[model samples]
Target: SADIIWQHCTVVLISPASALCETFNIKMPPNINVLRGSCVTIPCSFDVESRFEKYLDHTCKAYWSDSPSFTSGNAKVKPTKDMTGDLTKKDCTTTFNNTRLLPGKKYYLRLECKNDLKYTFKQASVNISVIGTLTCSAPAPCWSHPPALTWIPNRGQSQETLQENQDKTKVKTSVMNFTASHLHHGNKISCTAVYQKNRGSPDVTAETSLTPDISYSPKNVTVSVSPSGPVPENSNVSLTCSSNANPAVRNYTWYRADGDQEALIGTGQSFIVTVSKVKSTFFCKATNALGCERSRNLQIDFQCNETQEGQRLPQRFKTINEEESSKPKSTTQLLRIS
Candidate 1:
């Protein structure tokens, strides 16, 4: 009678034919780390006794078990859907797809053959460690084209190993690439590696994620005035400049349109001025590392009142034609009733 014994975290059957049992061997990585929601590959291989080898020639199955007993009745058993192993060749390479493996959990590998002896191996297992996804590399600055987003492999880095045996087992790597834009900022990009231990078995996967760092210049520039209506002569008014930008605007320059020339009036996001009898056109330039954007010209009208002291107050003001005002003007004179 064969007696089941647990030793070194492995389940083994000791029987009179225990010498033949020594021929069986299983090889796999001790542990693997994967990104959540991604795929992973498990490199696996095994050898069986010559007599039992015939049993594995057909109708053989592979699976992952939560227990070392390798019992099929165990509810914790997970079957691989994508097993690449060939019993004829004695290869047991397998892949797991989109595996959401839990962190700090161990999953064991098991094999079953459809023979009278009901051969099962539960001595080999691999631990699964779930970790945070990787982020996309920092965006490179671009003036004419969008930046390229490159994928960085896990901390362990992507690598492949070849196993030398009667049947050769090979491991492969996964990669992805894309272009990034401002719209993709803060968006998560993921990479997954899938692994299988045998044919028809469920897939196991490891995944990681990255957030794109997209840079862009200011857009939709506009200027706002504190007083909504016509400005009274000598009244103080405030002008605010605003725009949309990534990495934020580094500087805001206020400008006053004199005839056709724009004169830098102040530096900052806001400007203050005392209204004169003359109407004036104002605009602002917003700048950042990427580039600069100018706001649409704003026209401020100055209204005046005639005083009993014989001071003539202008009743209305007109903006100079932008086409004609493009030339530099040395003086801006308001209408006066002499």
Candidate 2:
């Protein structure tokens, strides 16, 4: 019979006197306060450089002081597009749904990762300040009474700039459209209109937000030929218009170069040009709660399907063998050989 006894510090601690037996690291995003009802990305990452033979396993944990003991049920876990417990690159992030970070309360998050050798690295807990919404307002909205410009001449300028006599731009409409900004980035910027039924009784508000890389103005404009290229006599030519404006399009107008006045082109996504022995030049213009913008002019040409000696054929003449039409021509050519 043999017995074995383990001795403490017997080899004088040959290995490095480090706290952890694993060689890996984990990190979290620096800033945490995020807007409410919006998606927030809690970025995390793992590194396993020392042991090439080992694999990477990543796991994230979140805790709120008011919540129960640290449990997986407290948070949602799902495999991202670039993770299988292998942390090779910096593509680790988690999105929290309906975050309820209390104000001035302590919150903690711990990350755990395992490798082929069972080595684990735990990160130092971080703190977060939950500010519901950080809105920096300038007392009241920069309101204006409307630009005093009498007219907008199309041939005048490629783009017109309007302003009030006080050197301020005053575009006074119920709805306001502004150039997208990061500060107003994905934020619920709203405006309350006090008029009509909404006057004096809790202003009627309209809220909206825009993400980066997205243009909030009129977009997705399309122009196509009706009945293909040219519409024959008494044919229907339809021109459709679309945009990315919110609240849909309140109204639309159709305009042509012949007149400065823009006629209301009904409330629909398309306009039809009825050709009855006559055709003209026209273009489409769209408007919404934001503003109105005109599209480039489109030319419609008529065709004379009659035969004329001076004009050449629109297409190359086919040989007799290829011609399927049995109709006789004004003159036919034939050759006789002896």
Candidate 3:
């Protein structure tokens, strides 16, 4: 009679249960990918057998384990603060935090009820794979309509992804990527997140900024001479060299070019040379820790000759590009006397 009663009970249980003796079933994605240092959510739902209906309550808890053999009582990763799945409604959704520590592999879910309803869903497993590194992240709790993310001075190729937080809130992360260049140095890059609420609610926004440090060689090196245009013969003139560079220009050098030969004349931000009867070509070099640059040549010439009436002639100066430096000098007629 006992055998007959046991067989009858088994047959009755099978009618209400989804599978033989095991009526509980869970629905969730098979695989999930997330960025390192970020969080991810495993959306899940489940159905319980008729016999276990009495055990379904708010007191039920969810657990995730790395090993398939994990039970409700012996869970490998039971995040006390992060287990967000509500079992009362049959929602087994769970959010995992800081995926960097979780090894990339298959993980199993275990449910523990306040009473006798406890089961481990081994039929369907979730594989957590850490795909890439996180570049930037911002809170996006409004999952219904996710916030729009943008970068200031938008320079790089960006990709947007959804992640979860410890509090089970979704996060909108923007991975703006670009090759590091010296041009990006000292640039104030900002990440702004705009959340457009429904109805008539005002839009909410958040922003963050950072400046990148980059090393680069000297650039835009230029030389400027004082006492613009013509000057008296045998008078002193000032030449200054400047450049745009990181770490600033540490050294400044002045050079004189005569024909095919070049000679170093002085060392400083400014160089003063006395005008002479012979025409001359001069240039300055600005240097920093990374590299150096040479400015265009400034050609100084005696533009005027003494008149028979004993009037003194004036001197003239002009800068030429490097390409024109090799060309022969041309004489200039006296336009006027100072």
Candidate 4:
């Protein structure tokens, strides 16, 4: 399910060519979101003149440029070999190492045919921007599917071309999906486009990142008691409540339930009390930003008849009437003594 959800992507395709010779089209997302230290797959596709179809030996070359024409001094090129698959086909998708991209820079895609004609399309190019080095707050939410827990890709993968829109525009796309865990929280994810002008020249890239928004409620709520088992009457007892949560629980409360109603007894993670009652039942509530959870009820009995020396006392103590009648030299006590 995570894999299926992670495979989701929103693609926008370039408008179809009005003329047969004007067959160059680049389809990609206007912007990309990525995590830091991760690789990015740029979905790309193109078409060429029918005449060039005969030149199977000719391969399509991809590049990035700061200028629209890609003739600027800062232009970076990616050779045909680095491209994901045979660029002579309709798909020209590529993968870029995000580490090579600089943040806050805008780049454009340039396509060229390596042949005697030296065909290069400058009339239309796609713009790419590199944003964020760490933590993306808002990632694109999936509309067709729920959010997925996945990891970034480490190696390059194959490309998939799908038809988009009512006109069935062929769009090339690459997917990188993995299982997401707590370790990925607050980390950056980036999608980068890599380009190189020549074998000896330096490579250039564009990328962006996002901080994942993970949400969960309190869980594993539990209550622990100190000096466990059969508490002595009037002795001090301690109770601690604990739970796990994403935002961290901010408040903890203790409650006592006797009969008809439950009453709040204390606040915080620890509750201390003098055990005077014969029996008592308590539970704790842990609250966080997401939600709250209550622990299971804990019952304690404080009627143990053990002496300081750990010996059991007699079951019967002086009755109320017997102790009152024998207290002083009252008439009844005097007559009984006489």
Candidate 5:
């Protein structure tokens, strides 16, 4: 039922004179998703009632029907040259070509022998869907050293299978379950297949890739002020807002926080403002088509006349005697301010 291989052949256990047609079944995958242009091989095997065992022969034919009715005359895919499994052995495994045109619908298998063995397995059906998925497959011509598959960036849960094609060739498939997010947008995921040779021959490798399209809101929004250090009161400074986003950020709105309320200052990526308070808090909002995000509060320090650099300069000055010794009788005026 899952992506794993089905080995055992199951029987329908139906009687000729009974109404047990619902018991008709087969062993195969329940669901399969493949690329549009690629082909797929369904591993199938089945068994009939013991009474009809004598009717099974090499002349038996396998037909894949789109409908469950036995008399619908709907033999859309008759695996004549591509039927790999031997009907005499009850293995109905088949391969269909030009799968790009196949409809995305469920399919049933119909078995018809030369004598009297005829039945449509309606209970066991396989649904096929064509789309782009994280399933990668490669041919394994040489089983001695089968190809090894590895995913680039090596993430997500994956399962692997070794299946047989119509020509009796082997194929190795790897299906990975991955979740898409903004963190991985624009990143390329690749699947590489490595094949090694025996007699010192060079190795062969094949690879395929997929890129996911992801859209997200703004992130890591922040506001930075020009002339970052402390500035004198009423000094002019520039504030800029920056953020990361897809489709680019549309606009930026600047906000200044006062005591308990916020005031809208301006718009655009950059804004010029005057520092009128001893300390001020500022932030910005970045918006795009998807959504918007607010930045953290940025505190700007303003230098005051008496408590900052203006008043500390005089107290740190050297005394008149100390300044004279260092200057060595230089003719510099030692004017002292009150």
Candidate 6:
């Protein structure tokens, strides 16, 4: 007998009375925010205890719901999406690409981490809001810098380094160009200004609101190389920038190719541009008070200078051999009496 053992060996398992482990563990921060028509990621960390054994497929299942009060009149609950569970790493998080949000609206989001097997959730809820200007690329600026003006650096609206004029005014000049689509209606387009107030100042903003009444698409643009072809070099090669427009064209800009630098040959609708140097290529740009037209790159060439070739007569003025035999008496010409 082994120390008076019991008649039959009995097995008993003991577990801590207070240690009833919960299902999935979750933790999140407060005051998280998201923007409308944008995406949001909810961070979560979890340690799956042995309790979540049944729901194998639901391991990846995630649930999201909006506030019930938001849909008081509607039968359906608020906006929700599933499969947000970013279970990639040991620290699982959730993300949502929310497009259902309206401008200046508030939304509450809740995610339910449900185990399909246990039909229970380790869930969390958060309240987020939408603010800030609803900005997309504004109408590609309907403006351009004429040649007379100095060229500023090519800067976009977002990265513009603003500078103030001598009068302490903002140089809010933006020379950009792009086609306008139907989405441009009623949109608040902005201009970058040195003065913060000028950014929102009615004077600084282009209130005309790109309408069809304006020259939305360049129209009635007529380009001509005056005197047509064989327009001699070192002479006036006129270029006319004519347009049938409402506002009418106030200025003209001429662009020439194959020059050492970008050259503005002339201004005005009818440009009397003299060709001094060898003409490689020629193009004229026309613009009104509204905007500048795209460049018309033309091809042109120059003829050799006829005056440069051959010798000239001496200062003594040598007589021609043919003139000697045909000499005749010179008579006095009648003068006009006015």
- Top TM-score model: 3
Q: Candidate 6: worst 10 consecutive residues by lDDT?
A: 1-10
For every model shown, what is its TM-score relative to the native structure? Answer: 0.35, 0.28, 0.51, 0.34, 0.48, 0.26
lDDT of 5: 0.62
Regions more than 4 Å wrong, model 5: 1-133, 143-145, 163-170, 210-213, 258-260, 307-338
Tens digit of lDDT per residue, candidate 1, span 11-100? 111111111235777777654544434566667677877776567656666766544554555625454534557755667676666653
Which candidate would rank higher by TM-score, 2 or 3?
3
1-338 in candidate 2: lDDT tens per residue? Answer: 11111111100000011122244554665555455444455665545456633343333322223221344344323334332223334334555554433222223333334423332233333343322211111111244322211111111112223224354434322222222221222333232222123346643323222222211233333444445554346667676655444324565566554556545544456778765544455665556543444555665656554456655323111111111122122121121000
- Kindly list the per-residue Cα lDDT of model 5 for residues 1-338, writing each as its tens digit: 01222121111111111122434547875544443344666778887888888898887888876567653356756778444588778888876654522332356788987677888887676654322236677878777666888889776777888888998988888876543345555566677888887778887787766555444567678776676655566768887788766657999999988977889989999989787645667888888875577787877654344654446311111111111111112122221100
Best of the two (3, 4) by lDDT: 3
Q: What TM-score would candidate 1 get against the native?
A: 0.35
Give the 10-residue window scoring lowest on summed lDDT in candidate 3: 6-15
Q: List the residue pairs that clash in candidate 5.
A: none
Q: 265, model 6: CA deviation in Å?
A: 3.4
* lDDT of each residue in 4-23, candidate 3, tens digit only: 00000000000011122246
Best-matching candidate per lDDT: 3
TM-score of 5: 0.48
Query: Residue 172's C-alpha lDDT in candidate 6?
Result: 31
| Candidate 4 whole-model C-alpha lDDT, 0 to 1 | 0.49
Error of 3 at 152 (Å): 1.8
Model 6 RMSD to the real structure?
35.4
- Candidate 4: C-alpha RMSD after superposition: 32.5
State, as a TM-score between 0 and 1, how close model 6 is to the true structure: 0.26
